[model samples]
Target chain A: MSGGLAVVGASRRVRAAHYATERPRRPVAALLARRGELAQYDGPRFGEAVFVTLQAIDLTCIRGERMIFSGLTFSVAPGRALLVRGPNGVGKTSLLRLLAGLNAPAVGQVRWAGGSLAGRVSYVGHLDAIKAALTLRENLAFWLAYRGHNRSLAAALDALGIAHLIDMPTRYLSAGQRRRAALAKLLLVDAPVWLLDEPVSSLDGRGIEVFMVALRRHLAEGGVAVLSTHQELAIDEAETLTLGRNP
Target chain B: MMRSLWALLHHDLRISLRQGNASTSVVVFFVLAVTLFPLGVGPEPQVLARIASGVVWAAALLAAMISLDRLFQADFEDGVLEQLCLAPTPLPAAVLAKALAHWLLTGLPLTLIAPVLAMALQMEGAGVVPLILGLALGTPVLSLVGAIGAGLTIGIRRGSVLLSLLVLPLFLPILIFGVGAVEAAINGLSARPHLLILGAMLLAAIVLAPLATAAALRANTE
Candidate 1:
């Protein structure tokens, strides 16, 4: 409760410098090199939309008898990301669901440019949601078609390094591979906002690097992302918001 | 929205095809349960013919129940239900697609096969067409009404029994009319009244069940 706001006190530039010094140069360079290959992918960008914003005010979430978190507020504009960090059972996923309009908040409001998040946000939760019996190609194609978006399935699979496994059933994939396939849905949709919960949990180091590249490109296209995680995302200029139990 | 609904329907059909066992189990149960009555009773045509319509109708009701619990549970557990709720196409429309797909896999097959099974049970010639027609108009109502039960019981563990409890009472009208139509034809009376009532129930179910199922799904997912 004491240092929650202080977590966002550090300037974006200062935090970027701190993150650079915190990581080893060799792997960082390797990650950057991999990201460069994925940078070529350009899906439908939300560029022309004048105002794309997500805001939450006095948000509160409760599970059973416990009040998980309360009095939380944050905002993410186009070209920016909001990173929610908290320990397990602190309502990180609940907050993301609230913003996604999947769950309503007990108190206060979550607004997206004065409208609901429905139809404008693409959400990826803890469960991969991929049909194990379906091939990766079919699964991605279904999601793209469901969202009414005509994005390239081949490029999305290629960017996620699962192009080789496209024709294989998702059941044969390892946990990390399955997670990467799920993450590819974000790239396949044309939504203005992305609400991801523990999106990197099962991803390997290389998979994380690919995801970072996709996320960066998404922000560059004037799309907003709000994700919750316990680990560092290492994205420069991303806003940090921490939630905890109120005393 | 139309494209999304079509996509969901196609995707659900593919999944049902891949699973394959659910529909097969329902059909197998329908055949086995229908076959049992003749063996349990004497092989006399009088007895089998007397009870043929009720036995087949009852068995069909149970068979349809076998797959009802599965209508929304698979998608709910896999997280696809949430994605479906968020889709630009209205959630009720998606529910309709899923229910229609469910009917195609479960009810439609039962309708086609019930007549064959009825003939095996020594059903008289008079009851033959009435049995097929009654089933054709009735099974879709089972699927539609069963979806509401499936949605309401999704969060309960070992909910199959509860699903039956919730939906069986609603299924009585369909079962009554289905068996009644065949009985009337066997008795040399016109079966049109009963068949028309079954059709009316199907029409009402098609219009209303999707809305109830969608609401229940929203409550469970939230």
Candidate 2:
């Protein structure tokens, strides 16, 4: 938790530039993935999210009898984002799931700092996972409690600009509001590697704006993001991985 | 870890209670199914007493089965199971919390209400204590074992039908010992052996079911 809090009222450029200058980057990112997967792997392992890198080395995804994707290679360094792009049924979601460790790669490895993906990734797939019966506050607070985060619940809500909807039940929320709430969880969760499958799928203009703000904030803090989105993201420096185009 | 598990347990109970009330449906099915026994067997007190233990045990097993398919289905569909598996607490411990919550929500209440149902069936007073005690010990095994079935069938379509086929056969030992305990007590014989076996089954389930269910979940999730 070293100076990990987002700088309040600081410009994004100053925040990103100042944070980099304030703390010298260490090669610890090379082993941040393995540190959490120690000899005893089950406990909550909160690694420093800065300077970490996610690597997928020659990964192959086999669903049933078909090889969905193969010989795929990529690495997302800290403070950067990987945009996974492909046509329908082109394995964007499959690749993300493999990286998230939801499905095992038939070959190669999806590693963080060259170690197992355990406890290092926070993944959000299409379903949102929000309880219909619970209020937005209850839903986010549950994830906070699950991660054992001591931060105030309102902090992340305010970041996503959904603080007013905190007490409202999620069942009453529209599809985009639920998606925003799902993105808000990315802030509450302290993981370095975030795997989001089609994150901006149903977000409106305002929801997309706040999401971009939060995503950049996450990147500025030296966290890594691997997201697959149908809409083109406005991130200038982010790398793109086009699946199925590989011969 | 325990705190997170407790949070999950409380979260599950709260959601279940506020929504469609899974446990209530299970209990209602349990009560109605038990009530059918006396009606089918006529109003003869001796006959009802003779069959009450078996009748109640059978109905409890079916009621518990009714709740089993839902144990993981909603969470799996909504993708909550993925987050749950990735949570800081080990998956097996998380499975244990869910299984305990299931028992507490569905099994424990079923146990408490069994005595009243037993009285309606004219179960002998001497057998009543053993009946309640057996249910208290036995119903957890139902929830735990049923969790394994639920986990294995998570993504399968119409899983409830397949869940019953997989779980009912395994439920026989618990049903046998549970009914045997009460029937033995009614027969003026020692129910200790039957009760002890049921307790041992419970201990075994507590240790094994979580690991099995976690593995099933992993296989299904992949």
Candidate 3:
């Protein structure tokens, strides 16, 4: 077990090093020039940050016969988390779907980086969407391949602690294990923002801690996340939006 | 874009293979229905030869329908359909890849087996070539057009029957031309016109069906 852990840790460091060098190097001269003044500014300039500044204004959603929610609004900026809190029927998932562009808002728009949200936004819905017949490795491979990259599959599985179940078919997985695999999907793509609906619903205590750790890393890297949860998240400085039942 | 489509196709084919039953059921249904026709109508060689093309084409059409709902239903229920929508590959192209995989599983198998079934039904030797040609061109259209009905009725319970009701009518032209090609061959006329028309419908379906299905999926999932 210690040997396996060392191998995983070693591979992760190698990949992280590869990412650092392969990525386009930022202008260090400008970084040093702006280092002193960086704290003076509240955030990136309006047009500078492409993935931040997501805003939802007066959004309304209605299902078959019920008005799930109405006149709801919020905003998510870079390095900030928007935690949506509400009761069971308060349309939390629906709102995430709206933001993810799976469903259009009945009344308003979602803006990203001061513009319309136009990129591939990652959404982890209630359903894990893993094929019950395929092994965990195959399931993750499908998403990674479909999204056109395999750079992070091993790392994602390692982070989620499902590296041991890589060869097992999803049908044999417990609910928590399956949820962990689903949460691993959030790391498979290079999505600018994550719309997570009940991201911790089926997770165990340790799974929840792992997810929060990964989410913090995502936010620290300037990605935005809109997560809905029934339990209180331990994320520091995350903004909260509470919704109530419709009239 | 091409990579994404390939990935979608690869994943769908893998699922179909692992599940093992969905595609097998389609083939089994096709074989059983084709075999049952002679029993119902009597095994007289003359009678069997007369209805061979119609029986085989009808059986293939029904077999295609039996599995059409499975194309999107599983993905939709499991939320993978939403992910597909959010994929960088435009939704229509993803739908096309899905339909292509479905045809490979259901349509291609039925086409390959049509000749054997035709032989059992005592179809003329010359008619066998046209039967295979007609089906190869026609069955894909069945999968494609069926995709529309599958998307539209995805949210409804027991939607397979509803899908048949909606799609069987659309299958009429393909069926008419598919069977007509074989009949023309048996009657000593050139089956080219019928085969060509079926090919044309396939071409048009190639362009339109995926687009329409993508729209329906967008609406229904929303």
Tens-digit per-residue lDDT, A162-215, candidate 3? 998999989999989999998899888877678899989889899999999999
Encode model 3's per-residue lDDT on B1-222: one tens digit a residue: 788788888889988998788778999999999989888999999999999999999999999999998889999988888888887778899999999999999999999999999999999998999999999999999999999999999989999899999999999999999999999999999999999999999999999999999999999888
List model 1 lDDT by residue over B118-190, tens digit each.
Answer: 8888888899898889988898898889999999999789999999999999999998888889989988999
Worst 10 residues of 1 chain A by lDDT: A6-15
Candidate 1, residues A58-175, lDDT tens digits: the string is 7777777787777776667566788988778777899888888888888878866445667777899987889988999889999998889898999999999999999998999999
Give per-residue lDDT, candidate 3, residue B117: 94
Clashing pairs in 1: none
lDDT of 2 by residue, A44-124 (tens): 234333233577777887888977877777666667788888788888888888898888889988766555667767898
If chain B of candidate 1 is superposed on the true chain B, what is its TM-score?
A: 0.97
Query: How accurate locally, in lDDT, is each candidate?
Result: 0.81, 0.82, 0.82
- Let me know the DockQ for model 3: 0.64
Model 3 steric clash pairs: none
Candidate 1 Cα misplacement greater than 4 A, ranges: A1-48
For every candidate, what share of the true interface contacts is present?
A: 0.68, 0.60, 0.71
